[model samples]
Target: MGRTSKIVTGGLLVCALVAISIPVGKEVVPGLFPQDQSSTVTTPAAQLPPAALSQVASVSELSPDAPLPDAAALSDQLKEALKYDGAGTVSVYVSDVLTGEELFSADGWTARTPASNQKLLTAGAALATLGPQTRFTTRAVTGSQPNQIVLQAGGDVMLGRDDSKPNEIMGHAGIATLAKKTAESLAGAPGPYTLAIDDTMFTGSTLNPYWPTEDVAAGEIAPIYPMALFGARYVAGELTGPRPHDAPVEVAEAFAVALERAGVETIGIITRSKTPEGATELGSVQSATVDEQTQYMMQWSDNYVAEVLGRMVARKLGEPVTNEGAVYAVRKSVRNLGLPMDTIWTVDNSGLSVSNRVSPAQLVQYLNILLKNPASSAGQELKGLPIAGLTGSLSDRYIEPPSWEAAGVVRAKTGTLNLVTALSGYVVNSDGRLLSFAMIGNGLTDGPAPLRTVFDNAATVLAKS
Candidate 1:
């Protein structure tokens, strides 16, 4: 029979099995079978309980042998859902992950503002260049002069002011823990020591010139620093509000306070200086692995973490660890995946800049490349994407209505701006075929919420296909 016919037949067989497993007047406890009595119906050697039947159905639903969704039907459904009346235009692209076949396309090749969706490219480059297992290090060492100590930045902006929490991504490396170690190492050796900060790891402007000044004041992002507590936020665990413009200096002050608490006397004034060559190491702490940080970045759409990852990617490639270097590294890495670079324009690693331009087709194509090899570095980046209605920025989304059907089944990255909304990721359709898609709405005069819903609805269509 034809592929679609085979799928229909198999689906009918599964329904029959389920219908026969439960007899009349028997209460089925969801996944469990009726335990009161055995049915008189005789057929197969053994019948599966509801739970086992569910497992079988799930396995079959994801089976590689399952049929693909009909392209024409999927196209019509998506076209209807993508229609918007408010203001802006919407672009969408969907493709079969296994065969690289384009299933749906609507203005997919047109470049538009990507917003935070740019984080996906940054995440991919970081994993490909730095490896997921790599961890950034923050070090405390003896300075050139007597009674001098240097706090060296190592690209870990997620440091905690308190003791390290082994379980967390934000505070995996704690300043207090490092201070204790440093105090112990310097026991009986000094009185008051001058603390210096070496934040030269990242070169060039700390803040992106392309970002709006008001956005920075509103805590959309802060100056990029090599080392920071709570990703440069003024307070730990607080994701929004005003941020310190001099994050490195704030970190140094915190370190000085931590040193005093650990029984080491500090001179109070923190200086900016490079660590002396061959300086004696006092103590150090390592941040969470790049994989963990990337997951956190994707889940929360963290602009700070995204930029840091990009700079580190530049460092790995021996490129200048500046904003320009980070951008170049990200674009180069994505291009190396064999994607066309002519259509993609990125001024900053974090998609906070309206100048950033990326097409829906490009995102879907990139996702397909990652899906092809699950074990590759670029492939591992997919694991960090936010799950619909379940995690990160999407926790409150996909919780209602037709879009709710995609909850827990869709894994994607969300992007937002005053007039732009975007979603890009992958989902396994009801037919068991893996599909990658990207939806971007720009110039939305009706506002972002409505356009966001449109994107969500489009994803739901793919899930139920």
Candidate 2:
């Protein structure tokens, strides 16, 4: 039997492991054992303290000598677990993180609608192109005309209406703070200034024509904008409902109101114009870091954030910054990572477009890349994936029996549409091997709960292996 060794680092662990062929077993490994610890050592679960009993194993505890899951047996188990009772077809791909070996694959090469899973690709591209430390700046500057103030839209769409909160992802920068700063800058200089907005950071259609208008009206998504208050929501903390069609104007109006409270009177009408060359800077605030924003995008599956990130990617790559540009930029960036972009099709950064097609294999391969060098900029993508039965979209899932066994061990990104569902991310298996998997279901006639169960059960099987 061949032996392999690898060092896993970044976001999770910095450890080395040596693999050898051995029979798979059911014993759980302590994720944080000392390096000199014996791989065969075991502590009965019943003998452990309650706190230790409740703790799930972390990746650091994995031993390279740990037996890999029997591929053939694992395939049999997954095939059975993946069986769906409804109409749709499911494609699955699972691989070992250490050796990049395919453990199980079922129709993995065939592309299917990825739904929100498309955001994974967008997240990768944005992280790679714009970098994890990058931040978008919204600035208030003197307009080309007298008594004119221009509000320039950076790439932040999650602006708060009140003071900026330094520790938050949403509203890291606030409109009211910007207004106060702008008011101070104009002290003893002017009154009743004309307010205007500059949103040229993005160009072309604000709304993706490929997305259904009904979905837009229902607030599944709104027209993409450079800046928005509470992520275009009418109320902060509300994830869904009617959203402003023109977010830039809305943010500017809020700024106007804030400016009035800051002792700077603003004209009632908010106009649209570009900041003049060499305009005097009045005030500016930055969005959260790209890493933080990406985490938020993944955790909540925010369509607006994903789309804006896509546009930002386009701008970085010198693309047109339109829907077409964003899609092109994402595909190109992912391809640059050496993944087979030819195998998948994407229409939008957010998987809201039903036309988007991605194979389970492609998704798994991407996860593998992230796992290989967890410290790289691309590795930051892993941090954004939602932990099962805990944070993000997976919070309510994997909490029930049969699936609960995998909770806290599986981290994944989820996608859901009326006819499509997808779950892709990495998991640390019972044998202590890190594994990446992707499951996508399409053409579904059944309700999503059943299909989600099927997917979760499959992931749970991986965790147990």
Candidate 3:
């Protein structure tokens, strides 16, 4: 009887230990593990900030037959795979903009750094504030000294020799043409020539500390004082480069040299400065509409163009040109439209700043603002987007078999960076169902394929569901 008592006592102790583990299991892996490891693997519920436990609870509760009543049982399987797909946290949301019905929402409120996906938001903002028909300009003025000339800047991102992709060209005709014509105009006037470049149009604000300074100086972000006479980057083959800026400077200097080759002699120092107004518009050029600029900005994830345009918007709205001022302008303009921007944080005009954060729902909500406004001149440029596989950055996303969800039917923006990937856009299903979806993957490495697949799969499911 003593030995029996000892065995029973031992069993009771083991049971008590197991009881402590049950909560751990329920808290960590949810349904599968029977024993709890809260002490070892889970932070106590009280210690976790609201988001940690909330994401788990929201992702783990998919019961297959509820939200997606159409899928019945397969729903839970989908949720399970997404719960821990290597992305520390993944959020997905689907909304019928036409009916304003949110069909599925999983951790949609959590804001994450969206990488290039932030481009979409910038594009949206550009369209909402800057008119769709907007164009940037670059002009030339003759300096006080004969044969000397100044090329004015307008912070045009598309300024390049190549206007092949429409608004992709930031500013002007050709520096060569402008310079050459000036040479011809002064053929008999000045024995020696000198050309001065004035970039006074844009205030020399800090060129984003987040961007590589060397590359930016070389024009990686976008050349400040750009001069593209013939087509730029697109057709700009061969030639050596200091950077993007160096390339344009070389081009401008080459034009001066070419004028010498044509019998004109330049003795004046070629320098950079701003050209005053009332300055002659010697051979001016206009950029494409804002729609075209947005398309290209997304295609290559061009942060420079987006941010430059952002500053331009700030200037237009009477905001200061500094980073802080630019974002202040963005916030004011967005709020002016009646959209709630309390959760949106803009550290820089571009999403290059790590401090930038926004939610999937907010993106959709922003898009909805454009959709509902038909009256906004700036909001109508959504046409510049690549229609899935048709063109631009999304040219190869969302593989569909000759249906509405196919390449040409669904149009959207893709975002990504280290451990963070996001896609937000409007899609139409084969059955004429219109859907606006936002998928954000955080805790993944910086790249697009994995993020692409998640969105593609989600779109496929969204289309069918």
Candidate 4:
């Protein structure tokens, strides 16, 4: 081509670049580009070349201006951002906390495994349906005789190690309370009486159906029998071992011994029993409110607690106590709030099974429902979540500056089991707007490494501009 034509083309190209500059900074594109010949970006104080090597200063006193991409504009584009890493599909949803604005989403409605994050749903379901003042009821019933009583399972997950005064037994002292109650009830029977328990809160499915049968028996995943009569041994923040097989029996023995120490003579055998018809109520204990329950469940990323909470959903909704029943019931609970919830598939309420899937969009919907319906039992439950960086799984997050309020200011639930890592929570952004977000990753080959920078960048963006 002719030199004159080349010069003319170059000038037009520069003009076109200037026009592009008007909207350049909308969304942060990739790295940097040259702003002028022989120099990068020029500023008021410094005169330099296209770039430098030492500290890599921006030469421009203006701190260098590439272009400003609208955060609100980029918000919608943030969904599936982790997809760039070529890992499993990642979905994100962020909303304005105050204005109810759905800032962004990518396949947000597409269901995906939520991992431990599912505990949030269980916790939320429990808190919303049940009141903060609500407590689980653990009761003692008499089936045959006064001295011969039945220690019935009443779905008390926090039942502790005592056996006296079943109604007000300290959670840790529950087993002992049971023992005490046994002694009091036997009150000098003619023959040696026995203590049998009825764990029928969940009848159809006794174990975590989603867990491998071998693993279900005693590992981190035990059969979620409706009898948390004894506290599950939570280790490394996960259920590592099952309570002894003779757990309840041991509790009965303690009660009997305590009574004998109190001068009551009795010989009895404590064992598991069937839930019989027309069982009578002898004494009982109450569970904490739904809010308190959620707090406990989420802070520790508990699975058994989630399972029990699922059972509670079944009980309250009058559904069957199977995995399917609980999922349907929870879905119904969400729908009852008048939100769209067709995109979720809850295989297990605890999210332990890879079969479980939830869309980032759906979580945001859940959050919106809660924010809009403050009087709602569910919203109240959401508030029970531990403060980020302060409680629950998020206590250690966002330890650095320039990071979003992912730690203390955010109240979110984290889900991680094996190769998956997830985060879902609420944050009040700098603009004083409430933002609900979900960051979920699956098939993380290097575990969660591929998604760390993505999460940090997103959080930084949300917190900054």
User: TM-score of each candidate?
Assistant: 0.87, 0.88, 0.72, 0.73
Cα lDDT of model 4 by residue, 9-48, tens digit: 3433332223222321210110122224543333211112
Cα deviation in Å at residue 203, candidate 2? 0.9
Work out how many backbone clashes candidate 2 has.
Answer: 1
Rank candidates, TM-score, best first.
2, 1, 4, 3
> Worst 10-residue stretch by lDDT in candidate 2?
14-23
Model 1, range 277-374, lDDT digits (tens) per residue? 99999999999999889878988999999999999999999899999999998889888876778878999988999999999999988887877765
Ranking by lDDT: 2, 1, 4, 3
Each prediction's whole-model lDDT (CA): 0.80, 0.81, 0.54, 0.57
Q: Name the top TM-score candidate.
A: 2
lDDT of 4 at 292: 56
Give a tens-digit lDDT track for model 3, residues 1-465: 245434433333343223223322222111111112442243222212233333332112323222322433334534643444443677777676655567667888888776666665566667667776677766556666555666665555445432224323343334445455656665677567566666544455546556545544544444433334322343432222334434346555755675676576777567775565466655555666675666567655666667766777777877776566666777777776666889887676556555678888887776666555433644543444444444456544543332223333345666655456777776443233445778887767545465567566666555444
Better of 1 and 4 by TM-score: 1
Candidate 4, residue 106: the lDDT equals 67
Among all windows of 10 consecutive residues in model 1, the one with the lowest summed lDDT is 26-35
Clashes of each: 0, 1, 28, 44
Candidate 4 deviant stretches above 4 angstroms: 1-86, 145-147, 163-173, 185-191, 212-218, 229-231, 234-269, 275-282, 401-406, 449-457
Better of 3 and 4 by TM-score: 4
- Candidate 1 versus the native: TM-score? 0.87
